[model samples]
Target: MTSDSESPFLQSARRTLQLEQEAVGALISRLDGDFDRACQLILKCTGRVIVTGMGKSGHIGGKIAATLASTGTPAFFVHPGEASHGDLGMITPGDIVLALSNSGETSEVTALLPLLKRMGIPLISMTGRNGSTLATHADAHLDASVVREACPLDLAPTSSTTASLALGDALAVALLEARGFTAEQFALSHPGGSLGRRLLLRVSDLMHQGDRLPQVALGSPLRDALLEITHKGLGFTCVVDGQGRLEGVYTDGDLRRTLDQYSDLHALSVDDVMTRPGKRIAPDILAAEAVRIMEDNRITALAVVDDTGHPVGALHMHDLLSSGVV
Candidate 1:
């Protein structure tokens, strides 16, 4: 039944996005004391922020809860209807409530107001009307009002929901800044993800250790170092002194350069072709940091050194890549 001449549908779609975009923009101009107080409350909240809403507003509330939780503010969403049916136990006196409703008069959410008040919990309501019952009962009212709904019928939650989401993001970010939340702390909470891999994984975890490290004595013949590289399968070897201090590194690139200058590979010692005082990393450094160092210097592998600059381990770009740190 669809056709190329669906001009009305296209116009409606464009209008909806435009209206939602404007609502989000309006949220910034409306922000004032209440917004600041909401952030302060969340930052000081010893317990979680319990987010509650009904229907479409509930969907937006769920995302808001996730955003707050990930950005240093501990939060979780609770369905208003379920809360009335005993999920109210989830909200405690130490917790703060974030209630979302476009009309600001959802019966399910309103029913919990007295109990929340009696328990001495703070209420932050995101609603379109400042005079609505929910707003009147709230300790802080975030204006999520839109001039009109994006729907042609003016019944859908589009613009109002967009405003609510933007305001929620603002609150979460403000709390994040007030708490001095760092990227490392955020990564700790997200330890199962790529962020965790980048922050928590160390070079020591991926670098070849003990007998597997590609290493040879400083005066070892180039052929013997090449044998070490082959045996370790890292495409390179560290050249160390008798005291285990890193003197230099020999790589496939060095082999190619040596081949161009002198055809006698067997007669050369590792010291003749090795790159001196080559790029190195500490074992405790993040693998992502190691990748950064390698990428910044345009090199493939680095010798993992100890406190006194002795080579304790070695790693290649492929090692980081395979370990999901690159």
Candidate 2:
């Protein structure tokens, strides 16, 4: 797809992608008892899963740790080299150690095997070799071998790392299912994310209440309702009875219709111009449900009512948008 000089590089890129794809695909058949054992070990672990690796494998291990932790498995990544230093103190007897090494013979990773054993910690090894030192010492060995690297020289940790990462994802997802990890729980782990906003945010968290709410008596002058709408900037005002129970709603749109139907604007009460029994929602509903109601009814706001049908709060489309619930 390029000029003659660039064609060779493009071909190389295509070949690399093809090789990596095959590498991940090859791991499908490799899932066996060992993979299940790895999940079991982590599930049984009362403490955190300590993931460690060297160089590029460390990068992949870090990503795997994040995936596991966010998906309900308690995990964190520590560098294998750092473990030989005072960092090994971070590992306790209750923790499980997951070591990543393409060759299964990285000196730094292998060095921790004895310390982990002395502490009575369980070991799960992901490696390219089945009989290497780390794999042989592991309680569970995940075979991550690849036929060849995407690098033409087969010297870089290309295909092997991809396969290991995929295998780690498989292990995490399996454990997630086994533990019955729910989306709400996942949202708790990621409270700063948009998914958390959708799953955990409720109507009360974003609704305007008290002095911020716009409301008027049902029998009040239309001018009084209009003043409430203009002052509150919610595009509408709730018309309520003496007991504060909602009787109707009047919005800017209703005002337009009122002007066309009545010549004497000063003579009308809010009850005559308001939409009676206006669309309302409870304060406990998910903000997402409120969004659906607004979209379905082609309206931009709703009155939040309590069990007694009294207006407690006002919600507008802008509130949802500003709160990142829309």
Candidate 3:
């Protein structure tokens, strides 16, 4: 009779996690010359990294390829079975092949060895068996061995797959740093995602430009500036000089401060009450940078200017939030 405290289900789950965790930890000591050689081979390759595997290894290879591609390394996955069926045409002479197999005996993956060698393409093998045929014939071999599977039967691939995935991530990140890949470059590759929008989207993309911008000429009455702010709904309006260069900005906060200083607001000019040289950003700068500027200064709006400090556009906190740039 199994008691609730000694439930076999809970015990099995905990054991599985522990085994897999230990398997990944064990890989730390195995990082040696082979791992370094693999990275060097991939780094020097002028062409894309071609990842190939069979069955469960293939699924992990696909994810590895994706992570590498997204992190500034050009990589893609090709199924070993498909590679045998004329899909080997995808491999160019300049490319590097990364083949994954736990036992290093996957027939589909191993069968491509002769052709890869014949083509003079560099091959990096990731396998558990150091003496396996696949490892012996490779230019570089990455050992992804495990003591045992997390499975109670010790047959299913659980810990082995986890180790392979972690190793793949480590390789990709190392290469990314080696190449000096910047966030802007990463954003360029992932333009459709939220991260891309935040890093790549510039102030010009979200700002209200031209007629949509709320602006009043220098010396305009406070009443006119307030009306412009209300009409444009940007919470503020830029006060510009005769040459369109920015003079100041008048916001609701400025209005409150001015009212406290002077009981009569209508008699004053926009320049008199406006905050001089308020927070501003260039049109070409990142919207994320604009958000940082706004947050740092504790302001919600900013004037987008040109090289001459001329008011070109207006940016608001709502603009960033709505566009997923905040």
Candidate 4:
């Protein structure tokens, strides 16, 4: 009955958290035969998982569909109300329909039951009532019942929706594991995401190759090496041999130190001033691994080399950033 602003807000938040926590706990305990059967049905579905719901359940269904799609399970959301009109054509016999109805009586969702059955597509129901018409008609039922809603009126879908979301996540993770989904495969599905970049981006993809690579022969003047560095814009040049094997590297840092020791920058040879035995990586290494190598070595760039130690390409920290590998 506290009417004060702070007290009411805190009470509402606390109640909401408590209700959602209880809903999650309930869903965890209810993972029995029905939950296993639901997983089995989805695993065997060769086409996709068509999710349909109404109102608050519709919002949850959209999220569930997204999770399933991103986790290697092909799924899409269809509004049951729209399904009756024409969207139902999106579903086929190969797909399994997952219908959501909190009260098990949403007419919009219930209306699709007969059509799904006629197509021989299995129906998996997620609802609060185990004995409701939706559950009885479903090939598998997932109990998403909650003790109560966080709403004081006990009417709004607060806890029930949260439970549905958790159950959906559980199902997604289960499917992801069942399909032996690897990080590389997941990355292919999400090439624009950070995780995707970390898993799929290789050093060869971002490394400067061909004529863009900065290089200078042993005994080449420091001024010429600096020009190569400037032209390449990578702030460094590799010292190479007759066979183009890396002998050393001359960086901006090395140039600064060299300037203090010698005033004749034009006369100094790269072999005389270059840092010997510089760090290098294979062409096939991952960009993420390149980042780790740079961090551990406290360097900003790396020279990519072939098995014979020939400088093939160059990679910079900015390369990883631009590619979203870091």
How high is each candidate's TM-score? 0.95, 0.91, 0.92, 0.91
Off by over 4 Å in 3: 1-10, 258-262
Off by over 4 Å in 2: 1-10
Q: Write the per-residue lDDT of candidate 1 for residues 178-266, one digit (tens) a residue.
A: 88999888988888888788888999999888999888998898989999989999888999898989998999899889999997788
Q: Could you tell me which residue pairs clash in candidate 3?
A: none
Report lDDT (Cα) of residue 147, candidate 3: 97
Score candidate 4 by lDDT. Answer: 0.91
How many angstroms is residue 120 displaced in model 2 relative to the true structure, after the best TM-score fit?
Answer: 1.0
Residue 18 of model 3 has an lDDT of 91
- How accurate locally is residue 136 in candidate 1, as Cα lDDT from 0 to 100? 90
Evaluate all candidate structures by whole-model CA lDDT and list the values in order: 0.90, 0.93, 0.93, 0.91
Predicted structure 1: lDDT:
0.90
Candidate 3 per-residue lDDT over residues 1-326, each given as its tens digit: 33568878878888888999999999999999988999899999999999999988999999999999999899999999999999999999899999999999999999999999999999999888999989999999988999999987889999999999999998999899999999999999989999999989999999999889999999898999999999999999998889889988999899889889998887999988898888889999999999899999899999999999999999999999999987
Against the true structure, what is every candidate's RMSD? 2.7, 2.5, 2.7, 2.7
Clashing pairs in 2: none
Supply the TM-score for candidate 2: 0.91
Score residue 47 of candidate 1 by CA lDDT: 97
